[model samples]
Target: MKSVGVIIGSIRDNRVGDKVAHWFFEKSGVKKNLNAEILDLKKFNLPFFNEDVAPMALKGNYSTEEGRHWYNTVKKFDSFVFVTPEYNAGMPASLKNAIDYVYPDWNSKPAVIVSYGFHGGVNSALSLERIITDKSPIKMNLTNTKPKLFLSKDILNEKGQFKNIDQDFEKYTDEIKKSIEELEELLNTATANK
Candidate 1:
């Protein structure tokens, strides 16, 4: 089985990214060849990318302890699912910082983006896809099926807590499943070539 990291790309307090990530993990885990785990950015606590040298220059030998730990964990995953939230129509700074902390580990790996926001976070997903695509240094083999998750005020209270995640997100399950299938296909193909 190929290991997949379902990364929660938000680190802010009271963020909804974890709920989204957990749903993705559960959905993806049922696949016969996938071993999925949720990687919460808050738990990693990576500092802002302040290394003197760029991550690409380090070639997997990170300078900071946090960077090294994050890299090692990421290295184990054959593919990834990025569960992100749109902040100001873009991905959160914490997600960007985490991505900046590693290079080769992300290169050539297949990944899917699942973004949640008012308008389903399409802009946020695009922003991340641009960074991880052929145009950028990360160069992850991204899946075309980018799933957009929307939040409705009716389902959220005044303080922004979900009354029922499953009920609110049921509509997006098919897209999420398609994304997993695409990721699995890519992972299988990559493994075959190697």
Candidate 2:
């Protein structure tokens, strides 16, 4: 079976991205062909991308220990699911920096973006998609069924933390499942071709 990394793209304290990622991971359920694991950026705590050469030029050799470890962990996965939150209508700087630290590992691999915000986080999702698909040299074979989760006040506490993920995101479960299935299909194709 192929492995899928579900990345929690936000690293802010008390962020809602964690709850969403956990919920998505659970919803992914049992997969016959894929093994899903959560890759929390908060836990990784990667430093800012300040290498003298861009990641693409490094060819998998990273200058920093953290960068090298991150690359090693991510390269094990056959595909990914990035669970992100919209920060001022764009992806978080931490997430972008993390992506910038790795290259070649992401090339031609399948991925899906599951974004959340007050207004569904469509802008952040689009920005992330463009980065993996066009902006960076690392091109990911992204699944078409990217799930945009809408976050309303009812589901969040007064402090902006998620209160009930299953209730708030119940409507989007089908969409999330579709994204995973699409990625599985892509992974299957890649495996067969290899």
Candidate 3:
């Protein structure tokens, strides 16, 4: 079995990213071949890029406690699924911050984008793919999850806790399963070549 890090990209107080992430993991977890876990950005609370050097080549110094914690968290996983919310045609700042904090851990890893927002966060997914491609050897999976429907009502109940609609949940689950299968194939190919 392989372990995948499901990164929840949104850090807003009432964000829908968590709901999406949870649904993705719950479905993926049922597959005996996959060991999935959600990596929430809110827990790290990483500060803005304080390192003088860039993370592109993994040359930067991560001296802060938060930076080290973030790095360690990323190192544990073989692949990633970024659950992001579109913000002004791109991923949220918290997701970018988390990615910027580390480098080599993402190399040779496969990543799938699961985004939700108006227009299904397609712009955000594209933007995120661009960023990841430039720095790491990430095999970006095309089978993504973007709820074309409004998430406000389904993801949040009147009391503010998260909720799920069966239909939308099924779509997300199917996409994640497909992405995972693709990722496994990619990882195997990369390994064989190495």
lDDT of each: 0.86, 0.86, 0.72
TM-score for each prediction? Answer: 0.95, 0.94, 0.82
Candidates 1 and 3 compared by lDDT, better number: 1
- At residue 136, what lDDT does model 3 achieve? 37
Q: Give one digit per residue, the lDDT tens place, for model 2 in 1-194.
A: 78989899999998988888888888865254578788999988899988889887887687878888899988888888998989988999989988888888888899999998988999999889889983456789988898998988888899998777888778887888888889888988988899
lDDT of 3 at 111: 71
Off by over 4 Å in 1: 29-32
Best by TM-score: 1
Model 3 TM-score is 0.82
Question: Whose lDDT is higher: candidate 2's or candidate 3's?
Answer: 2
* Predictions: Cα RMSD each: 1.4, 1.6, 3.1
- Residue 69 of model 1 has an lDDT of 91
Error of 3 at 24 (Å): 0.4
lDDT per residue for candidate 1 within 53-164, as digits (tens), equals 8877887777778888999998888888898999998999999999988888899999999899989999999999999996787899988899998888987888887888
For residues 70-165, what per-residue lDDT tens digits would candidate 3 score against the true structure?
888888877788888888988889998898788777776777777777567888887888887634354343334323323555556797555555
Which window of ten consecutive residues has the lowest lDDT sum in model 1? 24-33
